[model samples]
Target chain A: MQLSDSLNQLIEALRCQPGIGPKSAQRIAFHLLERDRKGGTQLGSALTKAMTAIGHCQTCRTFCEQPQCDICLSTKRQDSGTLCVVESPTDVLAIEQTGQYLGLYFVLMGHLSPIDGIGPKEIGLDVLEQKLSQGGINEVILATNPSVEGETTAYYIAQLCHKNNVGASRIAHGIPVGGELDLVDGRTLMHAFSGRRVVTQE
Target chain B: MQLSDSLNQLIEALRCQPGIGPKSAQRIAFHLLERDRKGGTQLGSALTKAMTAIGHCQTCRTFCEQPQCDICLSTKRQDSGTLCVVESPTDVLAIEQTGQYLGLYFVLMGHLSPIDGIGPKEIGLDVLEQKLSQGGINEVILATNPSVEGETTAYYIAQLCHKNNVGASRIAHGIPVGGELDLVDGRTLMHAFSGRRVVTQE
Candidate 1:
């Protein structure tokens, strides 16, 4: 290739992003080089700063520049005494977008995949247990994904919550609100039937 | 979003890439933060170095860290006295990968789009004309894309080559080598018929 060494290095480095292959990496590199050098410079500084400064919040394990995240530090969220556990930081953002759940969050960062060597401690369950044993939180909501690993991780965390005398509950599993029953998968339809709520009483 | 400041900035900066949207940007940010901080750091440095260090080659207008590209400086290619004019650096890379072309390239960076205010000067045609006048090149191959703007740019460059007594020819346009004739578009099929070459004597 006639590409300069720095440009080639830039293309190679761009592939580090998820879902960016060789073609996409080359496109991005050229786009930045040709049209968006300022944007490229901005992204470079942003990546450098984030990679160096961002760290897991001590209280919840979600990414935060400080020891504790803004949500954990907020008096209202802390006093609410409800902690929602999730697999990643994005899930925390998804739940926060609803604005209905005004509780704090505990990001596991990953699920309990024993095959991949991810255990309870790896997901920060020990820190969660310590927080539960400290005795201020009243409820722990398991908002993990509905995959096998997520379910196993939730169940283990529930057991830990019970050990510390705190109530633990998994989020409901059912067909999506806007989805048709027939279009839903079999297991999801079953969950919808079993978890059905009574409407307007008798 | 509950994302920290640095993390949020990183996500925002990631959207500057060509095809990445908000969702992809968030996914990339979370992925780097959760699993590949090292890769993220490498990409950061690479971007910074490339954005600051890489500049256009004086001879070809393609990306290069120094004054001229390696291909432009190579004695064998310099003495070949044949120049290939292309729309972008990627096209040069594509042609080089074919292993048939040994001549050097002149990258226009983009085609002429009058609506976007791009003209001869913007695509660096003046430099190309000057190079043509310098008298080392014998043949100038116009390898721009088959789009209307690409055609216009190629025609303009061909005129410049003729003015300077250099032979200019456009690359062939037809259905791809392995493609079915039935699947080919009308204009391409028409071009194939008009540009057909003779076979061995019957």
Candidate 2:
């Protein structure tokens, strides 16, 4: 569209983000230019600051501005014999949103997909195994997504944890909440039926 | 969602851009952390560089890293008494995409919406008029969008240009090419039929 060089550059940069296609990037770049000049400056500063300041947390492999993320550093969090393992920080956020899991996390940073060249080493599985072998975690929850890659990754992790003498289990796979059987995809519906838990409530 | 503090901060910063809702911001933040760390770093640098380096071109109000935008500086562009006046730099880009116009630009920076407290002064219309009166630009094309605010701003500028003895005309509003008459909305169809131009052959 022949945008000014600077605006074009900004749009190109923003397009690096997943799901932010060219049109959205252009719209965002122009909108930033039109309004909130100070906010634009702040956005730029934040981007640079975040890139420079944040790094993988040494304990959990989650992005952290500090040496250890707040979640990893907090003593108030249940440091019991339970650890929840997930594929990424986004998964960590999703689990945290439930307000159910009280244990610490061990972010894998990625899933194991042989097709994409992501192996156990690529996803920091060796580190996870080391943590499990240290013998503090009694229950290891494999909370990776229900996708094939995620399942394979979870299974591998669970097998390794079992070999290291740590208890491990995968999160249940089923239809999402608010999903109707008719509306749910065939694969998900099948999974939901197969993994159905017995109702105990009267 | 209990995101890591750094990730949350990054999302908050990204929310400044228009059309970036909380979910999209969160997705972008997480994607930056998950994949393409190098691309993320480049994006960060580009954002900082563009924000710190670019500013409004003094002449045309378009974004520029230098005193004047490249378009304004280019001697090759025909400054042949034609000036395309637009609401913003994005509008300039839209017009440029047509590749039919061979003229300079006068970016209004915003529309004239009194209810919203945006006046002619706010949009730099005074500066535009001043430039017109300097005897270089004979024709000013009002290329604002076909909206109430855009119409109000265009009419206001046209009146100013007429009073100052400069030629001004509104850009055509019609259904897009390749769009079906039946599929087109009522307002657009009406405008298209009304504004239909006479066919000509050499």
Candidate 3:
């Protein structure tokens, strides 16, 4: 707080990051100005360019610089019948890293939270409904997390797909693949039990 | 890495921060663009301003916005006879925060490592020698950390002060104030015993 006005301002602005606090902000600001001013300038200009150029993809609501995201336009990822619906663009990246599931995506960006007045339309659910009604997608995989808001949003999307005559399924909620039995939480255990599967002999 | 081009560029540039890696950089970039683009813009502009405006103080080599740093220009801190020579500007801040020392400071910005080609001139030791020759300073306190390079730098500075007829002293190396005896290392314990203070009867 005893730094120059501009430096203090930069530190303050850096705290807008999700996990960054005053100490981290100050450290980052000082590091940028003291050790890497050229990179700092590049970061500043890049920040402006990214913010100014990026917007929601028209088809999936994922962040992109064009009308549609590359994922939506790719012929390589042509599994259009199976769409993975997620809560945010970061989820898209997480799924993309697996190099599996060559399908389209729908980024809600947020779940339906009635108390905060974030309803279906606020997160582009209308766009999703329109896509479903167009009769191309055969299965809608609800990849939203198992929290209350996420569950509610998934249920609403599922009901919408059912009304539109498209198959809808929620992503399974259970113990993680590499999880230990004793370490798993109660809710996860319950879901894992409820979602039990049987092995078939061919 | 599958993020949009500008977002990926921003993430890559964020790696220039001292301790940040790919994961934290991506999280920071996504957080900035997704939830706080306005703040991102402010931070970008603030970086440009701070980088453009800040310069080293002529006398102390500490960051400043003008010809000299605030500490160097302040008339209240007039104990120019007792000077603290430290390795970096952060060291000056640390000493100033204690509110115990009231003296001018000289920041070297780095230690003296001869093999790496960082000799006296690289760290502006000649400028310090010139200051010492001016005859206003009476005692020079070396507050460098207790390390091979730091001790060497301190010894070299102490010799310069001694040659100029000025008193030279080093900050003590001992067990930290709240350190537990069992947890402290052997070398620190040895220093604690060596620098033991005498008890005076009340």
TM-score of chain A, model number 1: 0.96
Task: List the lowest-lDDT window of 10 residues for candidate 2 chain A.
Answer: A1-10
lDDT of 3 by residue, A105-181 (tens): 99998899989999999989899999999887899999998899999999999999999999999888888888899
Q: How far does residue A38 in candidate 1 sit from its true spot (Å)?
A: 0.7
Better of 2 and 3 by DockQ: 3
Worst 10 residues of 1 chain B by lDDT: B1-10
**Best candidate, DockQ:** 1
lDDT (10s digit) by residue, model 1, range B1-202: 4667888899999999999999999999999989999999999999999999999889998888899888988999999999999998889889999999999899999999999999999999889888899999999999999999999999999999999999999999998999999999999999999999989897
DockQ of 2: 0.56
* Tens digits of per-residue lDDT for model 2, B9-45: 7789889988788998888877876666667777777
Off by more than 4 A, model 1: A199-202, B200-202
- List fnat per candidate, in order: 0.91, 0.62, 0.64
Model 2 misplaced regions, further than 4 Å = A1-4, A70-79, A196-202, B1-4, B70-79, B189-202
For this target, which candidate reaches the highest lDDT against the unseen true structure? 1
Which structure is stronger by DockQ: 1 or 3?
A: 1
lDDT of candidate 3 over B16-87, digit per residue (tens): 777788998888887776788898888778777887888788998877787888888777665558889888
Rank order (by DockQ, best first) = 1, 3, 2
Q: Classify candidate 2 by CAPRI docking class.
A: medium
